[model samples]
Target: MNKKVFISGSISIKKLPKEAQKSIDNIINKNFEILVGDAKGVDSLVQRYCASRGYYNVKVYSIYDAPRNKISDKFRFEKVEVSESVRRKRESERQQAKDQAMTRDCDYCLVIWNGRSKGSYANILRAKELKKGLKVVINN
Candidate 1:
């Protein structure tokens, strides 16, 4: 079966882990459909590397019409609807809703976190709440 790997992370990480690169690369090479949020940091890095390598089975999930990162024009997207309440809230709240939506349809989630990012921690817990497979890689 084609695995749908959900990717989430902190916005402050400077480098992608080697293990992450290997796992993502393998997913791309094997043609697994990728589901990722359209935030900065880890999301951007993953999208950039995948686009550079011509990996096409990617679906960028976002709350706004446009993603925060520079997502490639070659990929498809899944936009999450922002509620009126969330519209009244902060950007992080809107982003968290998007992450929850993406996680709902994924088979497994790979989180690259620094252990202190609220967004990353929220996504990790959200995955567990939905009973989805969770794999966290603590980034330095």
Candidate 2:
């Protein structure tokens, strides 16, 4: 079976350079099921691209419900939302569940950021700890 790949990156998709988009395309052509956070930026683009190509294997695991934007809603990717409570204990548990799901579902992870944000960095670290392969794509 082809490995499933998780995509972690900046939410600012509009800011991505042309070269970065090319790289993402190349990665997607590898036939791995793409998993993304679908928050914004690279994740949103990846999901949209996959959906447009009729790639039903693509999925998005989000921390919250879908954004109110039409672009986010247009993508036909499967989305799983994790609940976040005001309570620290509940939030921690929710985050842990997300991490666990990511580890189990992803065989590899691709990070597309010049520098790491909290969520992207944590995802990379978790992938590493779980011994999943890692790929980093940078915009120039």
By summed lDDT, the worst window of 10 consecutive residues in model 1 runs over 66-75
Q: lDDT of each structure?
A: 0.85, 0.62
What global local distance difference test value does model 2 have?
0.62
RMSD of each: 1.3, 4.0
Candidate achieving the largest lDDT: 1
Deviating ranges (above 4 Å) for candidate 2:
52-54, 63-100
Residues 1-140 of candidate 1: C-alpha lDDT, one tens digit per residue: 78798988888987889888887887787788889878779888888878888887888998888776656888888889988998888888778888888888898899999989988999899899998888888887
User: Which window of ten consecutive residues has the lowest lDDT sum in model 2?
Assistant: 67-76
* Maximum-TM-score candidate: 1
